[model samples]
Target: MLYNRASLTNEELIKLYKQMLLPRLIEEKMLILLRQGKISKWFSGIGQEAISVGVTSALTHDEYILPMHRNLGVFTTREIPLYRLFSQWQGKANGFTKGRDRSFHFGTQEYKIVGMISHLGPQLGIADGIALANKLRKDKKACAVFTGDGGTSEGDFHEALNVASVWNLPVLFCVENNGYGLSTPTSEQYNCEHIADRGIGYGMESHIIDGNNILEVYTKVSELAESIRENPRPILLEFKTFRMRGHEEASGTKYVPDQLMEEWAVKDPIDNYRNFLIEEKILTPEEDEKFKDEFKNTIQEHLNATFEEAPITSSIENELNDVYKISSPTTIAPNSTTQNIRLIDAISEGLRQSMERYDDLVVMGQDVAEYGGVFKITEGFIEAFGKDRVRNTPICESAIVSLAYGLVVNGMKAVMEMQFADFVSTGFNPIVNLLAKSHYRWNQEADVVIRMPCGAGVGAGPFHSQTNEAWFTKTPGLKVIYPAFPYDAKGLLTAAINDLNPVLFFEHKGLYRSTYQEVPTDYYTLPLGKASLLKEGNEVTIISFGAAVHWALETLEQVSVSADLIDLRSLQPLDTETIYNSVKKTGKVIILQEDSLFGSVSSDISSLIMENCFEYLDAPVKRVASIETPIPFAGNLEKEYLPKNRFKEELLQLIAY
Candidate 1:
């Protein structure tokens, strides 16, 4: 007999019972494998099967979900092959991330599941993006993200909640209040009565439930999911439960009190739910035992097959595959006819044209909508694209970037902006880890353009004036584009937007309205990793990017010596062919950058010249860059700190040598 209130057929109840049992039994088998030196590691979700199974069963397959390591039931309920799960834990190549990332630290598109990163909170921000996508497309899909009681403490949690509430997007924040974050107790983790209280702070509806009761969890989540789909609002659900096992297999339960464990042991979700089924006459004890045996036997078969499969065999060549889907090498030349526009206007034109071209392209940032951004780069964007496409986000840099990654995960392209380049420190994790590494880890495309307004010249001081390109250039799986002229700015912005990977497009703040060049207005993409030869001569090679390229141009006019002046439009993929050829002919080179000398992009150029062009060198390679001290507010001191005054001196010395 099926429960009358639930309207669940006997088969659905039986299936839920089986789904919960499989993860528990599989974890038991995995624990044995871990001890026998077969699998490397495991995180046992022995007591938390119901939460995963119940919540996942409540939502439809189309609704996206982000889960954690303890969500083994989620994978099982979604009907992912048991072999893949076992193979994944064993780091096999057939695993979701091809053994690149272990456990639930990977997203599988087939299952519509995006697993969490080690840093718990960012997933919530990604949830916001997925929810926003659903809202814009009118898909009636409520996005859900899982977190522990401890994960609610992350700033991303607050940021995501606020945005979801403000925009009335369809999202469900599911917190399995397992009473501990690692070894930290709930008493120590927060001062609130429940994680659900955070919902009140965000003006979102909140609920608490007995997580050990599978029927209650299923009923509540089903109702909430339906409501979110209908009304398109965010909700927070805090399921109060206990961690009957240690956080992971290696961490023992000693940190948990003996009394607490004894209390929760009797309330084990699977055991209680089985007893309830027996009371309803829906299942018999003999049948429950039979079900366990059947699941165990099936799990064993998959485990045997998985273990027979060879573990991941890796080498440098294998590991290096798919780090990035780099921007294709474009051979098409721009239109011969052009109009003069400022560097910032060129950026605006490129963005406008791309928006006109791709309907799904989204532009999001702070003060970017009605206010036109701090520098007015996004002026009149709302009027052109409307609010859905042109979104003005909260001042949360970290979540904003992760949100863009979330959109990319759901088959949409995002162009996010940082108000100031120096502020990128807050959002570095998503850029370097999620966006940059997604393709390499799980083949998830994070096709995002993060526009960074960088460089020094105006007396914006340390917070606003910074050339932080070196940080991203050193990171693999990222394209760093820094264009010095308005033409390259418009052309490369088009290219960065077209790239299938994450791109950090650096716009020198000083050059936004300061310089102008004739640029094509139509949609066109210049080749990435290609540098422009502004002036070609043989006495010296003066290579620079961003604002310093202009200074190099001016310094060339001061000197009588003929030099090869090259502007690096893209930083990560260096135009080495152009640099090497020029270095061989010029024999002497002086690298210029607005960033500090040590550990800068210029440092890499200097080394490359010495290594590849050493035999042809006429003098030692010199570097002109900012002083070691922080940028000062005084105009004169700022000029002294930068390469504006130093590039000419370095070029003259190289020429004299």
Candidate 2:
């Protein structure tokens, strides 16, 4: 053993050195595999391994890490098994995700590392939520999130920093400034002198260091990590480094200058650090050679073992099985009485019941606390649950959504409300990309409910009212529900809160007080994915959801046609069996929708009828939907845009046909 050391002993320094070297070697092997068509793609931070090792080494084992794809040294520092990494690259059954994901896309709960998505910038906000959980537990733990200079340009980067700063979360923001974001130089990307400057703008104490120096990287990060664990404030750390290889082996270095590559290659982190170890006599030349050889041989053994395994096979049934978690039915109390409640009040009651049931349930969004949400759906919740459980966030929608995802993954439940469904565009990334894909990707349940107040007839105009259910219907992993009645709204919201997956619960703004009924006062849950048969008829089947269901009911009374009115409470996991049977019985169908005609849910249901009930149809399926245009602000134009008259005319036309 050697004696002279700075901050870390000879053993630890040597260990860090070896950890950095192993990833470089593994990446080199991955390149070979790529050429042989064994692996699909490769992204390497060849010259910047010191940042991952230095930062991750400072974190305690259980403190979470939201690493980017290039941070392979983090997995090494955390002692992730090399064979498992190899198996993932080889698409073998022994991989962490059982070959469901590829390289840098598998996370292990045991390691506290979140598997990275392709769009990595959003993870910074996710890390904030993980840190928030630790803070809530008062566990004195912290999180370190990795991103690149290019990633800093993403809106999520700004949104995350703002939320972390405002919440005083214990998050270590590590930005690796590799000079380029997939060939776009930093000069062209941003006007700021340094990415760390942006963090300072968000109220974080910022630092910049030479990423090539392992000792400097470790010393600064270790100090800040401990400081934040004690005081619980975010720290922004910038590591200036260069990517020593192609973006991937296939995406060649033609765009990168040879002179610059040669300059950075000579300053390769592993080679320079190895020299530092030998020059300081921390390791003898012979010891260094033996260490490199041993690691290389171990990596070779892992590769061989991983390649010998077969790829995991998947059937359509297996893939679909994980789309949702099976919920045990909850029986409503037989002695409970129905109370006269508005739709909005019923939603508040459901929130109260779910929060009272689970201590870890969190309610957060703009104006949710104190202000009781814009629609008053969470009125009195802050008084009942306290500010700790019901939080009013800044207008950072992306952070709100992604942070909820982070909380759910850590065993807490979250109900995030979008003040208006139109603004969901701000948080669309996490909803579709992260929340919806979490279960399908890693069997990780994001027990999150996003409450959206939707519809056009509310006269809230374009920015506040939009029927965007069609957007989520295209996404596979989300459960979309739009309830028309107070009872259905309360029941569906309760069920969504208890579900072990992400759910988009759309509450129609127009139906908030336009209709009221007796709703169950006690805690209960309705089955998700089942439609309610409101009326029975024989001539034509009228199917709809949300505010349009009521319109269909009213139109049925005006028309002199016999029809069956079906309220489709859930848009996805569609009650297709109910719809098919109804169409078969009626022999003619009219699907009503409040959303625009272009790319509407009615088109999908119409197609399903055509595919399954073609022989039973007496005429072509009819769709009554709003005109394909932005919602008009004028009351008269808005009324004209609705399809109420069209529904009656379509019913008469289909009857005649």
Candidate 3:
């Protein structure tokens, strides 16, 4: 099949030819560097440069773009330094990643280019989020995200498409179909011939174009981008191209046929566009040669200047720099005043007070506004704060978290809720990449609180029942908190809201309705990174958190042994002073948790005790936790699987030691 060359302008045809030539030359030089071992690895968008440059040139610079790893042409056309790009490929600090991020993760905030998160389809959800923020701010900016045909198979892709359509977000999903995902062909991956067919299921408009034709790519992308900006709807585009080389430097095209390679080489986009330019009389042979020489010299000068300068180096001290904006220590004093309040009431009141104090705070999630959330944690918030401040989002976990990250980045304090802790994994990419590492990567504080209901005791079963604190405790730049009673819940949440970093507020499903010590009616806050001593004893120290604290307290009363009960409020910053002091007083220690034993918080606590308080201990630290298996659906098995009588038995053994 052939396309007519009479429709396009001569200058536009010549420009497309020049763009393709530069990227091809740049990739050839990179392949040479890779072969010589000057660069460790490289991924080239060799045969698919037309789609990248054409689409990027069509969009406005003020708009946001989330390009994938194979988008060097887009970045180059956007005026990202070629030298910096090469330096990044060589793992130098002079690259945009500051010597920390990989080559594909390049981005500059000044260019309105949101960084490319390496995760496959998760960036699609985040692109919708950026568009959502722009809409909320009344800014006329659209978001464009690039992904491969192989990525459409991921659940996140479908999830993001659904949400973008539902919310009418100004986002464009570009699918660059380069024929293969590494060695696997598209025929083996999906039954559908084109990825654009899947977009129909989500009620989105889609297009399929010849990816090798720069004129076609540019014309289609320009129209779709403008249409999305005007109507604020999502668009899905499928660009059909071929992979001329291996997927990456490590992969070889041994399985590919020589005939197929020769066939694609004959239809090279750059050569085709060059012929179109000559047919249109855009340039003579002498003029074309001059243009090629000028571009090569300009690129060489940029590369020379970039490589000659000193590169940024990584250091151990830099790791400690961006966790939080550490200001001069401000003294905080706890109020002695007290009043009675219920657990649920305390949570609602704390949110009210925080919202009243900070105008930047915005709360959103599934059923958070109109229905007041599933657990009623956000009850009466919409009526009190108005719709702009309190929003109800569709049941899209990944989109909800990604939108929260966008809001926080734009100087808004965001509080998002996961319907249940088990669903948090759906949004794990943005939570780990954007929220957890925002400050660490760009020295930007992300004030976001993710409220999730966790723990199993009310028969939520395997799907609904899960304790995920252990999953994020090991992650840097995240503060995990679990409160036992109403007072701590209110105070700790308030403190977390005030923090300039991301915090995971895990509320126990069992403790939400359980009666506990009352909280004060007046506004107050509790300092984070501190533990409460429920009971003081000398025999053994029993440390626990959240609903497990209640079990530990009950076991201490039943047994004749007097034990020290310490409630750990903050999982990330463990109260070392309080824990060590209790361990010193009692030579024996028992760590109790409701989660599985493998890689749980109990393991970290036990290791900490052995490392810091080993000399003061008489017996080895014992851990009492749920069995290392999935929570069963049956009542009897679930009861047996949970750490019930085990805590008492472990405490007794430690005390008797």
Candidate 4:
């Protein structure tokens, strides 16, 4: 069942058999290394090598490959040095990531192979973006992104597939249905009878193939890749294969049923293809044995050479080298203006001014170019900047973030917008692994701006409303900023753009149209890691950011309490100097956020203050945030769940004490 009835010539069959044997031998070597403790871990493609080799053979060497963790066969067939792979496994200096990234994260841009991202299903969106860029440049290259059957359950997979199909991008999505995702099988993951059936929802051409059949896989993928490269449409190839080993080296085969393993063993891709080759007289029994022996000897020599080389151990020093690409001498300054401004306009004007100042700034997102985005923050950008700079992208968050990374790596300042902050999870992998840590990992700076509309209110349901600042702020090497007023927005955003590190610019949707203030026409910048003191008071220090700062200010006005209000514009590089100084001056403090109090940014600030400024505190630091529940759709329930504007009342009670 693993082989097709179509006949192949002696030479063609020989090639297929050889390719399969190479991966099989390599996998066996890796498993031996793992058992000997020479390698840290192993994620083998033993039973699935046919599909991997076939897919790689179908594409040109110049085409891009964005593979998942189970892609050893693809890399091996592409002539990736076996020693370099062994070095990576042993955590050596000559490893693909220079010992900084994991084994599966290796890639070579010179070989036209984009870096591997291990996050499930996210790479598909990135592949779409790469294909789109090729289309824009009128390049003939196509992109292939591989994943597993379980990856289809992720939201990013659907988002990417829909966009690719709609835009007709030259992308091939290959899903290797290996039956198990760790312990959860494909039957438990989806309701569809076949993985290819889900492709209909995206209006893509789908194919179901015997993943064990190398010849069939190569022919089918070659035809699809060529067709999409010419017509530029999305194609989904679902290869039904089986995993011979457990998920990883750490996982034993105890969870797998004996009967299923036995059945799959009989259909071993390597052995079956070997039999096919001998039966067709493509390879004599002696020739097959000699070929394997030679291959094994070569792999053994490479493994020894790789192990003899010293392992990479100096990753700490390398982490500091790529924080920012262009180190501008200019540091941002704090805003001294007494005039107030709204947050939304500040972001728009900040982007506008930044684009005008720098010709390399490119902005893209859903409805960002012509529709001005869902918030109309970028409404007139297309008219002023033209289509090249201000472009509208398909609703593919993963692709959007990955494209931004690619552009930034090639000397462009990419400003990407996520229609809403809640949907950022769709692109979380690219942002966290690629954007946030690319500079740290690759010794290359990724200067990109991610603008996200966040926060709750206006009766938007749980899916639409969320304040996930804590998620990004927790990640190191990334700068996070949330401006409350127009002045702060313009200043902080300008600072973020000027920063060499990746910055997450979060804008509260509530302040987009409702809150307005006078912004300066002149250029101004705010310093990173500096907090804005809205009101200086001696009684208590009320620390907040984004929309909460405005609420904190209004509360002070109503309560008539002299409170020191600190607007923490930059979340990652916390302004400890300002916070400690204020906490030292005012013994009491109140931390506030639109997110839930538990594990919120406010909680982090409270911990910082308690750890560093505990002796100076007059009372325990209090926190006020939304209830620990999903945002409700009804107005009354939402209002009850969110932080009320009764901070003044609470402040009065504290002041009376």
Best model number under lDDT: 1
- The 10-residue segment of model 2 with minimum total lDDT is 326-335
| Model 2 lDDT at residue 281 | 83
lDDT of 2 by residue, 136-240 (tens): 888898799988888888888888888899989999989999988888889999998988887768878899988877878887788888888899988888899
The lDDT for every candidate, in the order shown, is 0.87, 0.86, 0.81, 0.80
- Pairs that collide, model 2: none
* Candidate 3 residue-wise lDDT, 334-402, digit = tens: 466666766666777888888997776889888889899898988888888888788887777886787
Candidate 3 worst ten-residue window by lDDT: 325-334
**Backbone atom clashes (below 3 Å) for every candidate:** 0, 0, 0, 5
Question: lDDT tens string, model 4, 16-98?
Answer: 77887887888888888788887788887879998888998889988888787778877787888888778877778776666
Q: Each candidate's TM vs. the true structure? A: 0.97, 0.97, 0.90, 0.81
**Local lDDT at 244 for model 3:** 87
Segments in model 1 whose C-alpha atoms lie over 4 Å from true places: 1-5, 326-333
Ranked candidates (lDDT, high to low): 1, 2, 3, 4
What is the RMSD of candidate 3? 3.2
Clashing pairs in 3: none
Quantify how close model 1 is to the true structure by its C-alpha RMSD in Å.
1.8
lDDT of 1 by residue, 1-657 (tens): 122337877777778888888888888888888889987777777888878999999989878999998899899999999888878877887688888889889888989999888988889989998988888888888888899988888888888889889989899899999988989989998998888988988899999978777777888899999998988999999988887778887897898879989989998888877877888888999999999999898999988888899867778876665788644645446877799999999999899888987899999999999998888988998999999999999888888898888888888889998999999999998888788888888888888999999988889998999989999998889989999988899889988888898999999999999999988767778888999999989898889899998888888788787988899988888999999999999888888888998999988888998888899998899988889988888889898898787777777877888
Q: Give the local distance difference test score of model 2.
A: 0.86
- Comparing 2 and 4 by lDDT, which wins? 2
